[model samples]
Target: MHSPGAIQPAELWRLFMRAMAVVDYARPLELLHVPAADIPAGHAWIRVLACGVCFSDVKIARGQMPFSSSLRLPHIPGHEICGEVLEAPGGFWFQKGDRVLVYNYWGCGRCPMCRIGQENLCLNLQGWVGFTNPGGFQEGLAVPPERLLPLPPGISPEQAAPIGCAIATAYRAVVTRAAVRPGELVGVIGVGGIGLHAVQIARAAGARVIAVDIDPRKLELARVFGAVAVLPEEAEETARRWGDGIGLDAVIETVGHVHTVDLAIRMIRRGGRLIGVGYRLGDMASIHTPRWVLEEITLMGSRYALRHEVEQAIRLVAEGLVRPVIDEVLPLESANEALERLERGQAIGRLVLQVGSFSGV
Candidate 1:
């Protein structure tokens, strides 16, 4: 294999699957052939191995996500990418055949947030791959070298792919943002991809975990992921069962619905924290302002993982402290089915698309 730093041809064609339109509900993504020369500058060429299908992708494909208007059509909709470095610009450190995972956040590096190592919250944001920019639903990826994280040994590309977003986002919410500590009771709402990982990360942080979801299968999987208590979506009933009608220490809400937000707030104890990681468009929830002030509850929103947080999340997976839960592995052509599963909330942990075969680390 040629090294990523080795320069060769300027024009190469690659086969890729991409969402051709947002209006078509029957089929949103399809395969296409595009020239390598069309890839944006300052990006390394990577052979995409696997990409995880996130609920955000489903929303984007359906034209339901916030800022969905910014997406250019014929777009590829996958952000959690695992790939092998095929080529890199001069001075780039990655080499050919090196396994790596793409960090979904791409930011203007000169901003204060980027300077502080929080590129995911960049003030002058460029756009997230798979959302605003070209993503890894295709056979290859053009990624900024700085956005690539090395794939740890013993973790296959398929396993590490979901870590790019699902695990990384959960770790940031539970470990970095929430700062969950030992003996604290942490509640995870909606045990889907990110929520399931949140339960594991909270448990690994030594916090007692309580997970709530409408699906019984997901709740059962949450128990397997180390959640001490699992409950249905009835927040009132859940609150009654835990802490003797008091509340929880922290609640991570992954399903961004009006009622879920209300439920999260209702189940929090005084001086507790609620971190929101989900986004629902055109939906509003009301909170009792007086109660919020009196109870001293902190409501915060967490986006994707920071660069350092993504690295930390990867290390946790490498050490076996956390594992990526994959509900199904499908081919690139099965992207529609994967998205449909996510839209229906049928996937337990994550649905990954194996875009291309990898030789392993």
Candidate 2:
């Protein structure tokens, strides 16, 4: 790989972590060299410094998640990204040598959702950065200039990458979807990467956060994130006690399993809301309709964040209101190991991959 200063003519190397067929586990990501001329117009070339590995990456690698068939073989998988600008088209705002974080969602600009600042829910959705498009697994990527957000000072690229997805998703769940208010009791299920952030964001929103997770360590970590209570086991019993034996005001379900969804349903108050940010493909949860209607339960599915939400999440991290809980930082060569650790339910927070050199930029 060439150094950031050591410039070649116009080509960049990338890891093509593709799976030709369904497998039990995630395979190693392969490397490839993409020519500059091959990149489409209106996109800026960026030198990736760090990219965070998400749990959804594991599901996609195992062929469990439903992806578009249009995506060809040898696909590169990584959404959470922080990089430095290398090249941009004329008249673009971003110049070379700018430190920036790539926004994961790339929606069609003309869509009503995009025009209304809800690009994450664009009616004509194109795809996400790492899922449908070539992602930050590579040393370099070509992204739209509008999708790049300026990285604030004092935050490293590794810390900023996961903000693009993990923290941003949590922000949407707690702040936007759930609309957590002051003095409300919020339950954060699954104290993983997204859940941990949800814990802090809920706390920041003045809600009493009760964290529920099977992992003891994550439950403890949740306390550090300002969770008022922790429930390692008997989530229903503990949540009832925390909510005065009734239920919580809102529940952020990050695990995305049938059980977690069901638990969130049982843990919410009569007029409570359940915001789902996790992806459990092909899994179905049974909800009692009579109770759901009688209780005025609100079930909302929050995808990634919009452009404005990305900026808001970054500001929270910048101001020290919310911290990115990173478990491990590894080189790009250790991508497979990182994915395996995340898949085994061992990661407490986010796992980041240091792809390229973070030099002067």
Candidate 3:
């Protein structure tokens, strides 16, 4: 949120797009210039068009991606990617030149979760695009053929990437954690990429959405996306003023800050539900259990979306229920710059690396 708008904030969008990859010296993404690889049987690679930037990418660039990894130096940092298939190993469901959206999480197919068709939370996922494996901030990508989903006609690649990550994550948190219902009221905290989508999808599910964000600009964006009204840390006063209120029917906490979490807890009605969606680091925030027990509050943790859930997100985009907000996209040449923007809270929606673009069937 711009402070009063009378003051123009510094760098509404960052100018740098540089990154020191895990495998290479800090370099401009364009200068590094990696080549696309051929697809071998049972493997698939994509020619990346647009890849949405993510908070986790910021962590990985700073050595934050989890697991004991032998990350190739010069690793590309992007996960929310959308494009057409360049090559597909046999037995895969795709073909060359089909518009597609990628599922970011990678899991082994034999695991129970995968066996039941949930691979996004894979137990033995080798590596996700932009984390351990080569990602989409390049001209193309090589992925497990099964992880790619064919997109409905007319869905732009730029729009697809955000849904793959931001939209899917929010959708999963609401459906799996919040268990939202029609006509219920939803109090959503942190109205950025994930937060904004939580509002739209909750509204799509028939819930009246009330958005909370520190920035007035972001809250304005939330209102544009159909939020009933934006709460600028002023909902506490509003709630008290509206005497008929019983807090919120559901609260989705996308902010990891301790104070924000406490506020989210206080905003929900008794018998409410809260989902923690942010990928937080360090010590966990202290949550008092007595209030949760006495009020019968429900809390759940949602990771990435599974296959079916991801499909649902794609459909939401196709139907125009939600739209991805892209602040800036660098050419992988600006990885460090992108991450820095994330660190400084200067980016909106998901920042992306425009690795390369192509046109074909």
Candidate 4:
């Protein structure tokens, strides 16, 4: 077990850890000292190595998401976490110094959804890391042993960080919810961080993917990831032409705007599926009920991935099937700058924050 030099374990909880906090909505995160909390009986104290900056973090920071109102002030926001175990209780699968990727969701274990391995859909969620509780934007975190997933071989902490959210969420949308079939025509709207990953995942599933975005750069990146890129105006025409004049077999909408949802619904053929993987508070989409009934179109909402899906996503990365595209890496102190870049639509892929050094592992 790793110790804090000459200091003892009893003194660890008394020390302060450096962290970035959101003191107010629509404001920059401020650097502050956070008191370390005592580790519970079944929990472990982790030293954070890296955290991915998600657009959801941007929304939460700007108070644009529905959960923003419930968020406590001075909360640390970072869900995609990769870290090392500094201290863990006995009789657990992992020990101290082990590299781990956090699953983020802490569901009520007794709930019906959680009983069936669907913890992401738990009826009574206990806490979600970086959302309902303190997150990995700090030097250290207290996490339950069950929420920690083993970081497989051949992946760095920085690369593995986003697997907790972006890649896994895309995996759930494309593989689990949509069940994309080989030789199918798939349309992915809003080729941003998650959308780009969705494009790659669908292609890896043997489907022909068409990526739609307003930005030329994102579309170009999607093309590089093995998708036929198209603009918003050209999406419907391209989908019809590509799907042999019917429409796309499935549409994965990652932008929750009403306009994007409408576009996604319009791109689907008869009996096609529309998977909604993103959303904004108070935004609603209107569907034409007559056409919907006649076409038998299906609309589904995909939350985050299940635990096994996250493991599969890790395996995909470890085996070199899909690669997480990261735009830049910055020090933890540059979090505000990274969020600004994301807010301005300047990030092509994901931006990560390196919180601590990862060496000899």
lDDT of 1 by residue, 1-361 (tens): 2333443443132432232234343466766664444456777888888999998888778877666666567677889999998778778788888899998878999999889887877899776888877788887777889889897679988899999999999999998889899988889998899998999999999988888888889988888877855565565566657756788889999988988888888888888999999878788877799888988989989988887888999999999999899999998878889988887878889999998776433
For residues 1-361, what per-residue lDDT tens digits would candidate 4 score against the true structure?
2336745764453267778888999579999888777677788888899999999888877888777888889999999999988777788988777899998999999999989888888999988888868888888888888889998778998899999999999999999999999999999999888999999999999999999999999999998889999999999999999989999999999989999999999899999999999898889898999878889999999998887899999998998888988999899999999999998999987999999875333
Clashes of each: 2, 1, 18, 0
Cα lDDT tens digits for candidate 2, 30-120? 5455443334688887888899999878766666657644556566778898998877888978888888989877788798887987777
Pick by lDDT: which candidate is best? 4
Task: Indicate whether candidate 2 or candidate 3 has the larger lDDT.
Answer: 2
- Candidate order (TM-score): 4, 1, 2, 3
All-Cα superposition RMSD per candidate: 3.4, 3.6, 9.7, 2.4
Estimated TM-score per prediction?
0.91, 0.90, 0.85, 0.95
Q: After superposition, how far is residue 196 of candidate 1 from its true place, in Å?
A: 0.5
Tens-place lDDT per residue, model 3, 1-361, is: 1133432343211122232355533433333444334444576756677878777776676665554155666676677888778567777679888878787777878988678776766778766777777676666556777788878887777778788889999999887668899987787888877888888899889987778887777788888877755565687554434324677778788887777778777777778887888746663665688977998988777887887788999998888887777787666667668777877877777776665455565
Most accurate candidate by TM-score:
4
By lDDT, rank the candidates, best first. 4, 1, 2, 3
lDDT of 2: 0.82
Better of 2 and 3 by TM-score: 2
Tell me model 3's lDDT, rounded to 2 decimals.
Answer: 0.72
**Cα-based lDDT for every prediction:** 0.82, 0.82, 0.72, 0.89
Q: List the residue pairs that clash in candidate 4.
A: none
